[model samples]
Target: MATLLFVLHVLGAVVWVGGMAFALLVLRPAAHEALEPPQRLALMDGVFRRFFRILWHVVPIVVLTGWAMWLGWYWGFGASIWHVHLMHLTGLVMAAIFGLVALGPGRAMRAALAAGDRPGAATALDRIRKGVSVNLALGLLTVAVAAWGRFGG
Candidate 1:
């Protein structure tokens, strides 16, 4: 059961963080070079729609499995090492940032694109990019904490 929970937790983080990394690093640059504003915005809209849908489910799984590991497997709260606490803190903050992007700029981008407001969509996408950038950095940091902090200590 613990193994299963750990696997799920890691998978959830991989999907979210990996997806962000690819979208930000690879996809964004390729799309910018290959497409114009209208096409680029449209592509981003579609990509975000699909990604956000997946994340809606993934986020909960990640949170639940993480909690199960910390509270159930690790002997519940305050009993684990500092790395675990850092992971929990960063994970929650990342989740909140995802929520902000999905609810705020995400919706705006969709609405703006639907109404043919390219500039508005661009603005929203820019905001989303910034949020994703921050989250990606945090995700990498959390990953490092989870990986090295265990053995380094």
Candidate 2:
């Protein structure tokens, strides 16, 4: 079960980080070069729509499995303070950031796409861009903590 939880945790990290990489590095540049603003915004809408579907499943499992892993390692609390604190704090912060993404940029992105407002879509995309950027950074930090702090002393 612990191994399984670690696998789930890694998979969730991949989805969130990989999605960001695709969006920021691959899709954004390719769209900008290949299309105009209207088409670019439309493409982002479609891409995020597809991506967010998987996120709905991924993020929750990350949290659930994360909790299980931490609680399962109750014995490890004595192993290292950094190990436990890193897990707990990063999970809490990640959850809060996910909530913001859902409520703020996610809502606006859908609304802008529905209204077919190119400029509005751009604005909404900007918000999502910022939010995703933050998420990406936080996700990286979580990864680092998991690796370096796992057996911290």
The CA-based lDDT of model 1 is what?
Answer: 0.95
Model 1 steric clash total: 0
Query: Could you give candidate 2's per-residue lDDT for residues 1-153 as a string of tens digits?
Result: 789888988888788778887888888989999998887887888887778777878888988777777667554445445655676677678767767876787778789878876677688788888877787787778777777865554
TM-score of 2: 0.87
Off by over 4 Å in 1: none
Model 1, 28-137: lDDT tens digits are 99999999989999999999989999999999999999999999887889788888889999999999999999999999999998898999999999999999999999
lDDT of every model, 2 decimals: 0.95, 0.78
- Among these predicted structures, which one has the highest lDDT? 1
